[model samples]
Target: MAQAPDHAPDHSGEALVIQKVQPFGEGQIVLTTPSLDADGRLEDRHSAYHENRSPPLVWTPVEHVAAYAIVVEDPDAPREHPFVHWLIWNIPGEATSLPEGLPNEASLGLIGGATQGVNGAGKIGWFGPRPPPGHGLHRYHFQIFALAERLTFGPNVPLETLVSALKGDTLAEGLLVATYEAPESQ
Candidate 1:
């Protein structure tokens, strides 16, 4: 009674080619900040970075994808199971797009060469948007899975063992959702 990790990856869907991006969830790469505050202006909350800063990814060029896995969860964090802030697999299928400070503790170009896993505040790479002040707005989701094979699960492997070894070897999947609010300090 606990199975949501098929991870898709059997091939033969016409060789493969799926594109499902909800504009802001599929591909838009929005970072905001051109001037609209007052909830109408550019709305500045200290925009030096972060806004979807790492939630606009997509992929579909396969030919033996050896590795590529990303899982950023938030599920309206209040603590439970949907809190894994981030977790990267191998990533490197000719790459697509993951620009926005990404796993940036310094540099995470986004590709199979990428590395990181452990967010939820445990800190490893990217932990922005701290919502808790009033706990009103909180919806941070960024998922990009694509793997035919290529993972070792070393170095951390939190997020429930990287979603349980990515189940079936997920072939392709992309998602992005951003929203944060935690201002009520003194």
Candidate 2:
């Protein structure tokens, strides 16, 4: 049996501190909005059916991090492996939040020196959750990594490249989860 590529070995052993995700208010890593409801149904406006806006994200900063990376994936996708929805890197260490609805572009000018990579759909930046219709509820995992060194890679690198580079260099990490289910009708 093949080991999961997304499951990095937990070597850091509780040394890394992951703070609560801010969008859900307090004491929560799993978040929800009317657009991304608690019932695991995403609003059409936040899906491919409509506007497809990226949800806002915020977290407490870690100490001594030189840069940060975010990876969003759906482990429940009916495939050989999890599906990547977003890959963002080179976020300035001082940064702590991503505003809602970032443009589908490579460079996010408003966010300090941040850049986006290709998503599972092969599009740049965020590709909001749009699981196959009636595929049931899929959990979207939003993982943030604090790196000891700033990444020197250019834009649009594959997620594997980023993950490979992160080995042994992760200073801290955080996680947030949201769920979405495609409407049965379509």
Local distance difference test scores for all models = 0.52, 0.70
Clashes of 2: 0
Residue 36 CA displacement from its true place in model 2, Å: 4.6
Which lDDT tens digits does candidate 1 get at residues 46-124?
2223352444345455555666666656566555345656676676766655554464542245453677766766767
Model 1 bad stretches (over 4 Å): 1-68, 73-84, 88-116, 120-141, 156-171, 183-186
Pairs of residues at least 3 apart in sequence or in different chains that clash in candidate 2 = none
Model 2 over residues 46-149: C-alpha lDDT tens digits? 56656788877777777777777888877777665577788888888898777788888888778876888898898988888888776677777778877778
- The positional error of residue 115 in candidate 2, measured at the CA in angstroms, is 1.1
Q: Pick the candidate with the highest lDDT.
A: 2
Query: Model 1: how far is 13 from its true place, Å?
Result: 37
